[model samples]
Target: MVSMSKDTPRLDPAAIVTSAMRIADAEGLTAITIRRLAQEHGVTPMALYRHFRDKDDLLDALAARLLADIRLPAPTTAPWDEQIRAVLAACLAVLRPHPAVAGLVPARILLSEPGLTLVERTLALLDEAGFAPDQATEIGSQALCSLVTLVATEPGAATENTDPDTRDDVIRAKRAALRALAPQRYPHILAAADALTLCADRDNYYDLGIEFAVAGIRGIRPATRTSG
Candidate 1:
């Protein structure tokens, strides 16, 4: 005869990832060793193996876990600009909370259910805004990539000490140097340099880009209408 008790407690894979994320958020990815996780949880390393195949598998789980927290507003229900804003805001929020995991996000293969869910929502938003199938796919890919880079690079690309004015000046100087390149050598780039330098507000720029994309898709709404 066997006795079943609710007091025994359960070891969830999700809980393991949450713990790993805590360690990562504090000391980075290197801190997330199987042994360390086991020690924190008062279990053996082999116990974690039961949940994750190895470290990479654990990382995949961590990425999935981090992604799962972000929720995109329903595109069908919300205004197009609002929906896009909501998604980007959510993406930034998620990454901001887990600084250690931000860099790893773009590299890891995000095939997990949560990852797929995020992609599906993004595609649905594009489709709702009237992007053609191919266009939606391409835009979603590009938008996601751009968002990741923007979050990683903007605000603080490097940890050097400088006032905001000095930092802006440094950025401006860099752009000026790029602009100053011989026009004959890179005609189109030089032509666009002034326009690029005018883009100062990172957040505002992102909003504008997303708005333009949404508007572009809306313009094409008359051409092709597809339901997702």
Candidate 2:
């Protein structure tokens, strides 16, 4: 099949993965299958198998392609916080762009060159920001994984289902169910029901998280240095 590469007019793997991602995003991951991908491309199933051995191979390929698009910007000369913010923002944009893959991201084990590049870039950013190697790895892991978790749990396209009204109703209902609890045992929660029911603006929440993380890192750095 690879020998056919020149004459067969190779289908762009990146394009195939983009289309597949759209399907997964719209219909859920289970809807992604070799038959479906072939149909989407107007190609024979045999052609797809030539490109990817199976669904797992396709998934791995898709992840690597997605990561490739997110090459980290150089952090040279920028304040550490801004650099960190850039990384987080870039990562969020990349993951959010492929909502289907957002759910699968946390489970991904780096198996391709692009994936390795991403890991290296992340660690490099943390190291630049003055974190010890171990600390950098830990922080990078938590931040990147959290971005996937956030996007997967609250995908932009699925906002209607997770709207504030629906969320508040569920929370209130849960609070009401706890009515049987002795007031003394849960006094604070019971008293703060109204405050707890208040909804925070989603954009602000995202910004706040980024801000908090950057601030925490800055606080930990030495007073004489502002290089991070």
Instruction: Give the number of the best model, judged by TM-score.
Output: 2
The residue ranges of model 1 lying beyond 4 angstroms of the native Cα positions read: 1-10, 77-81, 106-110, 157-228
Error of model 1, residue 97, in angstroms: 1.5
Residue 24 Cα positional deviation in candidate 1, in Å, after optimal superposition: 1.9
RMSD of each: 7.9, 6.4
Q: Please, what's the RMSD in Å of model 2?
A: 6.4
Error of 1 at 8 (Å): 9.5
**What are the per-residue Cα lDDT tens digits for candidate 1 across 151-223?**
5554444322356788678767867887889988998888766555544465675666556655654555433
Residue 57 shift from truth in candidate 1, angstroms: 1.1
Clashing pairs for predicted structure model 1, backbone only: none
lDDT of 2: 0.69
Worst 10-residue lDDT window, candidate 1: 152-161
lDDT of 2 by residue, 1-228 (tens): 123333555677777788888787667778889887776666677888888899988888767766777757775787667878887777777776576676555456377776677778777777776677777777777777777766665522444336688765776675576554679999887775544444246566466666766676667753343446
Candidate 2 segments whose C-alpha is farther than 4 A from its true place = 1-10, 106-109, 155-200, 216-228
